[model samples]
Target chain A: MNDDDRTAMKKRVQRLVYMAAGGRISEADLGRYDTDLRQIGLDSLGYLNLLEGLERTFGVAIDLDHEEDHSFLHTIDNIVRYLVAQGGEAV
Target chain B: MNGDPTRGPIQDALTDCLGRHRGRRAVVGSEALSYDELGGRIHAAAGWLRGVWLEGGAGGRAPRHVGFCLGNRPEYVILYFAVLYAGDLPLLLDANFNTGEIESIRSDCGLDALVIEPAKAARLEAPGKGDQVPFADDVVLLPLSRPGAPPFEPRPATQVCRFTSGTTGRPKCLEFSGHAVVSAARNWVLGTGMTGEDRTLCLAALSNGLAFNTSLLSSFLAGGELHFLKGAPLTRPVARRIAESGITRLVAFPTLYRNFVAPGGPDRSAMAGLKHAISAGAPLWPDVREEFRARYGLDISDYYGIAETGPCTFEREADHHSGLGRPLPGAEIRIAPGPEDPDGPEETGEVLVRTASMASGYLNHPGLFEQRLDADGFYHSGDRGRLVDGRLHLVGRTQDHINVAGRKIDPTEIVAVVSALDGVADAVAFPDEDLNREALVHLVVVAASPELTRAAVAAACRSRLASYKVPGRISFVAEIPRTGIGKPRIAVLREQLNASAGA
Candidate 1:
């Protein structure tokens, strides 16, 4: 992923972590926020909401077939890795 | 078609829009929209849909089934009525159905278009990619919601399709027609003695029958405001919304009522204005039914109907009969005069009904459609019931009935007995074929309290029922997995039993 793509992905993830927390966690805790995915308080619905939020923010269509392949979406790291591997290949 | 019976169905309902009617709250989420506002929205939605079809691009290609994949929103209400005005069938989809299932349904039904909640639309696998009728977040806005729209005639035989709760194995789509919708709404209105003055509190999701037809459409037809509960922890909030909204009537399934009446009941002040309460979807135990009545001073009107057929039968307000009441107007009830006659009434066999409110058939599956509706037009309900003293008392599902030693025993009777036991919260009894001679297996979920042993459950079943009818084996569970409507997942329970047996 390019520097801008990486920046966008990071920002998207941060926004997602906040939205999924649903006021349970504050913005001030963003620096100390757990990027372990589970500690971010993203439940299944929250995870889904995050995906939708990312799609809307990036203005990119996510190929559902790829995102749900399980080799992806296990963690935020895997998602970023998948994105890098795709190299802007429409997902 | 544009005359009395057609317009009359919704005209009187629209009449309640005038200020003379009593103010009662129906839906509670972001803001409680008044009856005037709700009615105005319905009117405006109808008009907007007409304008879209007439002037804009929704073009007239023989009005097809319009799918509504929306959640509990004011826009959903507007869209529902808009579809009605368009003379199109509104195929209601559950908000909880996974993307795969939802897509399957959209394709299966060949939905002309879909109206999704703007908020929920994004979460869909592909929102804008599919044939979507995108409405704004403020789709329920006032000026957009006018009633004076050009009349369009709905196809006389058009029906709405829904997937049957497929505990029997594969889910089959069931169809219900415009005639059925009107008839069911009218039956409920008559059954409950609902008036313009009676506002309704709907605790169930807009997708389920209890809330969908009975509360939403029925209330609209009866000139009653339908108040919706926003989320879980229903009792307190629903009760508060009802009191605040002046909702005189409440309709829900047994499980929902059970949740309310469980430990510390709903705040008395929250439900003081409520007069009528009804239960359906699952059998309400006599004790629980009585308890709700004693607590609320409102008889829990027992309702009986399946998704295949809309609201078919309801308890008469005049006499609170224990049995599922007689068939509603324009509905026929048959006891299935077969070779076998049970011990109850003269012609009591299986409860078969032919109703105007009955669905045409499963969507796209003509084989299932034909299988469900016989040559005589009677829908074989697959439910065992008896017509005693002219009222039908549902025994249980015919599929779940056990044939043990030349005797037929319904598992409902066994489950009922088990459910009555101390510490037992819920129970499901099914015939275990893996066991010899088809012995009934009972799975019990006990409340958090004194531990309930299998022996205790067996003993309780033995005391209440005959030895053969008693469960052959018993299993304890933390909680029985239930459907959204609160019916026990008997098939799932059987699967778990089989897995354990294999182990």
Candidate 2:
């Protein structure tokens, strides 16, 4: 994907993370794309909601068992890379 | 008899169960274990536990308190049984408990040893933490040196203990007898029509009462296979497990059911083999139930159970979708009339329950559990519900405790944590729903200074309390409206907050 497209996907992923957070983490705290979502209080329940949002919004089904490496979900940039790699484009 | 003279009723029953289904699969997770293999593993682990305690000079003492602080897995099951078989009290603790909570439990209820993950043991800063003995790949037994006797003691009949969330970071430990635990399992097996061929996929934590009552001993009593998923209870993976494993029963909470009905969820064929989808912990939403039924052609049975009372009710008829089912075998429900109730035939009152599987009492807080019981031995369930056509229909809880995703959290705990922070004048925490209709703890704080932000308050909560106890939503307010009696007027405050947000 192009640089601009990549930036757009990261923004979209950030927005989804905020929505899925359910107010557990402040939007200001989630601004950095490289920050670990878990470190900022994104708990297990938040991750469950985030997976649902990813599937509903981008149609990306994350079978956690199949993924040997879970770093793709660790940061917004990583999630953007995975989504783009899976042919998910900015709507 | 399994050749053990000191075996209690629970151990004997479990030994008999294993013998009856010797070659059958017992627990399935990352690996599967047959009944015979499981028995052998439990025996070996128990012997190792005996040796460890004996080496620690605790052989002749009272039953050692062995706390389980791990998640649901095959090893967890084996170790729990091992602790029991070694003639020690198994204290099942929530795996999500923070270091502070564990320390509090260690202080309140004497912990002789803890079966926990190696990583957690490394970080734990308990006062009496001793040598760590590795049990499984990720599990270890970390022995603790008891400084002195605990303030309170378990009853002689008590064999196991579980916790309920309490105020100010102290969880109340409820004691249960081996007979009570066995009664709950047997009744569950009989009431739910569990058979030898049934395969159960349990998504709830084994420490929680929902899974403890339904999945743990009951699955073995019925000679069924108990399965545990390794990771998060997402929709696709859960559905795949059910379909691939031919799982007949799904014991989980309501959030999981809601996910199955959401857009892009697994298809109906994925759950074709699921015969019983039991939802507990929190109440299942009506819309989610209807949607799931419409989509999957299966009704999610809304299970009604109390922390003090084991399995209370189960809906036998799939067509009967309203109310929390009839009482299970060996359980009775009584709805006492409220003082303000009319003389109508059907009156909604406080739910009182008497079950053969009732807890003995709370070990930490003495006389607290007994204070809730009446002359008839019925424990007054703080819930307000009525009996409709022999089914229990809950309206709301009379207490102020907030139920967030089935875990009851004391709002005072949240308010106390926030109030202790600098620049915080007053605060009130209450049960609130997010945009997705999920239950969350909403902490509304009246900041003394403009510099005190939501992030500051959230960070304080994260550091001090357990993750589930942390506030989901933090909002700043000018002042908190209180009644003349110094009680928070939550309804009025909610209206004001809603109006201000709209403005």
Candidate 3:
């Protein structure tokens, strides 16, 4: 993936996460760049919805392992890396 | 609480009352369910279910146990009654139950079918879980495999089978007779002064024992509209719902009350026609209770009841001085000493209660109900409370089970999940409160493998247990302190976590 694509993917991921947690989690509750959603008071139900949203948004099957690892979902950098690795080359 | 009007089956009463009040509104939200509309939806759902069973070549004699996972929605009420109306036992499963947990319930409770949301249905990868059959617009039904051929024995008296909350990892299914369930609702209406004119907004899940016993039956039987709030139970939404729905009674746990009263906003008018707020399944902190009273000018009624037994006590006055209310007329209570102590009934001990509305038995486990339901017919509540001036003041639980908000987390469930990982020599899970005084699972482990980490355990648990059961904090310890009989001393572990968190 190109630099522009990677950055765009990261932004889309962030937006989708926000959309999934629309009413339940607040943006202010999310912590520093590396903080996980669990640390931000996002309950398990939030993660489930986030996973579903990501799947629907990116058309990718993401699992719980990515949710737990900091290098996968806890930060934008991790999420970008995951999306790129999941063959995000098209378009 | 004392009057037993020899009520008929709840499904019958609901149908009759709904027919009588066809023009009246039953549930109001984005859309409304008039009694006539609600009855149509229930009939449609029941007809669909009956047709599915008939197509599957199921005999009319066999009444299957049908499980469903649903959130706060108008369809929940419809589907629940529809299942009963179709001669199947409505089994309410938690929406958070993972695939493995669902399978375990199927095997243990002989669950024949499961209706869950499509997204949830995708998560369940159980073998032979049939192709999704659309049960409702929001949820789908998947047939589960139950091998036990129980010779088509019908429990004519049992209306619904709800799982009870306990610290034990093994779930126990409690069967409530139609008479018992109806009586329980009528008693609450009689005891709490719930009138047909009242409008109730329930914040808790319909499957929750608190809501099932108090709100569902009492509201409908009293001819009140039971409003449901979707999404999280945060303060603003709850306040907004109360205002919009003109909710006179707000049924929820204590933590929500704390959040609502924390801010200096929301006057009596903000809650629209709200007259009363009910809190149960956990203790209402004194300061929070006092703050609510001072700000809202309304007393928070504290309710006390057991899952096995029906409504036990209720305190109408907010300033009961932390005292629980007296028992209802028919419901009897005995405060006996702990099993270890040789105390008499006069002294404060375990709260043993026997009511006409007590559960018939644990349908899942053959002999388990007998163990809790004493020979004298009183089910031991496992809670320690003292009756003072004819009012009950709860001391605490005799066991160290963690009650997080209203959800009970079995420490053993956590231990089992964590220990299932590849390299943990020993592990202990306990409940600890954060600065907010809300409960979180805290775990300590003696890792034999250097590769084992908190993230690994949490990830594994996410796949196995519900997210709430996952540990908020995990630490490596040398060894867990235990009693001579090999019981882990959880209180010491709680103290250690408190000290470390403070640092």
Candidate 4:
């Protein structure tokens, strides 16, 4: 993915995180793409909702059982990188 | 064989059930375990537990308290039965409980040992912490040294204990007798029409009353297969499991049902094998229920059960679309008259439940459970509901606790945690919905200083409380409206917040 595409993807992933947050984390606080989502109140339930949102929106099916490393879901930047690696393009 | 002199009724019943279905699959997690294999494992685990108790110098004083702080897995099942077989009381604690709650449980009710995951056992740094013995692959038996006696004791007949959210970090432990538990399982099996062919896919935490009453012992009693998902209950994985395992029954909370009806959810074919969909913990939204039925062709049976009284009622008929179904067998529901309709039979008041599967009492708080009971043995459920054509329809709760998803969180606990965090001033927590309409704890804080940010308050709460107990929404206010007696005027506060948001 190009830099511009990655930036757009990061924005989309951040939006998904904010939506999944369900007001648990402020939208402004979610601006930092590298900040750990859990540290900003993205709990287990939030992660579940985020996973569903990611799959529905980006078509990236993250099978947690198969993925040995869960850090891909820790931050927006990581999520965008993982999504791009899985062939998910900027919509 | 009539009964074993050494074993309790629960253990005896379980042994009989397992022996009858020796060749059948009992439980499936990462792998499947046959009834015969499960029985043998339970027998061996019980023997090992007895040895542990003897080594701990509590030999003659059988029935030590063993806390289960793990998730829904086969090891949890095997060890739970083994605890009972070894003549010990098993306390099923929410696996999400933090170290503070675990310590409080240890101090309030003496825990001889805790069956917990190794990762948690590694982080648990307590004063009376003892040696950790490996039990299963990822599970361990961490013994705790009880200094002197605990503040409270369980009743002699109390065989198992489960907890409800309590104020100030101490979860109220409800003790149940062996007979009560066995009766609950048997009634659930009989009422739900479960059979040996039924494969139950339980998604709720086994510590929760919904899964505990419906799936745990009842599956074995009916000689059925109990299945547990390895990871989170995501829609795709759950649907895949249902399709692959031929799961006949799905016991989950309302949030999951809502997800099933959401856009991009799994197709109806994924849930083709499911015959019964049981939803509990909190009220299922009407729209979600209808949408789920329209999409999946399955009517979600919204189950009504209480922590004090086991499984109260279940909808038996597939076509019954009305109130929470008629009371299950061994259960009776009586609606006391409210002031509006004193002479009518259909009066709506507190739901009074008298069930053979009722809990004995609260082990921690003495007489707290009895305080709610009336002249009859019926326990006041605190829920306002009227019986309509023999079906129980709930109106609302008389209590102040907030129901987030399926877990009942005491708002006072959240308020206490936030208020203590150099939080300047007043705070009140109440139930509110998020963008997705999921239930969440809304904490409104009145900060004394301008320096206190939302991040600070949220950070304090995240560190001190359980993940579920943390408030999903935090708003700062100048002052909180209170009644003359210091009760929060939640309706007024909600109006003010809404007006400001619209401004």
Best by TM-score: 4
lDDT tens digits by residue: candidate 4, B344-457: 445778899999999999989999999988899999888888888889999887777899878889998998888787745999999999987888999999998889999888
The lDDT values for all models are 0.59, 0.88, 0.72, 0.88
Model 1 chain B is weakest, by summed lDDT over 10 consecutive residues, at: B141-150
DockQ of 2: 0.57
- For model 4, how big is the iRMS in angstroms? 1.2
- Give candidate 2 misplaced runs (Cα > 4 Å): A23-26, A55-72, A82-91, B1-6, B55-59, B340-346
Residue B339 lDDT in model 2?
75
Ranking by DockQ: 4, 2, 3, 1
Candidate 2 residue lDDT tens string, A1-91 = 6788778778888988987877667678888999989778787888998988787778776778778789899999889888878877543
Supply the TM-score for candidate 4.
Answer: 0.96
Cand. 3 TM to true fold? 0.82
CAPRI class of candidate 2? medium
lDDT of 1 by residue, B1-503 (tens): 24322233434344544344436443445666666666676667766666655544234445545666656666777677666655556777665444555555554555445676544554556333443344665232111111222122323555455554332112345666655667777777776677867777665557666666677667766665766554442454566667777878777655457655654556566777877777765566687777776777677777677667776676675346478777766667787755554565556577788876777666556657567676788888777787777677886555665643223456666666666777877777765532112233444555555677655665565544544455555666667778999988878876776677599
- What part of the reference interface contacts, as a 0 to 1 fraction, does candidate 3 reproduce? 0.07
Query: On a 0 to 1 DockQ scale, where is model 4?
Result: 0.72
**Tens-digit lDDT track of model 2 for B1-503:** 12332377788889999999999999999989999999999988888888886644224557889999998899998988887888788999999999889888888999999999898999988887898999888799999988888888898788789999999999999999889999999999999899999999999999999999999999999999999998778888899899999999999988889889987788999899989999998888899999999999999988789999998999999999789899999999999887754653467888999999999999999999999999999999989889988999998887889898889999998888899999999999999987767789989999888889877788799889999988888877788899999998999899998999899
TM-score of chain B of 2: 0.97
Model 3, CA-based lDDT: 0.72
Q: C-alpha displacement of B187 in model 1, angstroms?
A: 2.1
Best of the two (2, 3) by DockQ: 2
What CA root-mean-square deviation does each model show from the true structure? 16.2, 2.5, 8.0, 2.3
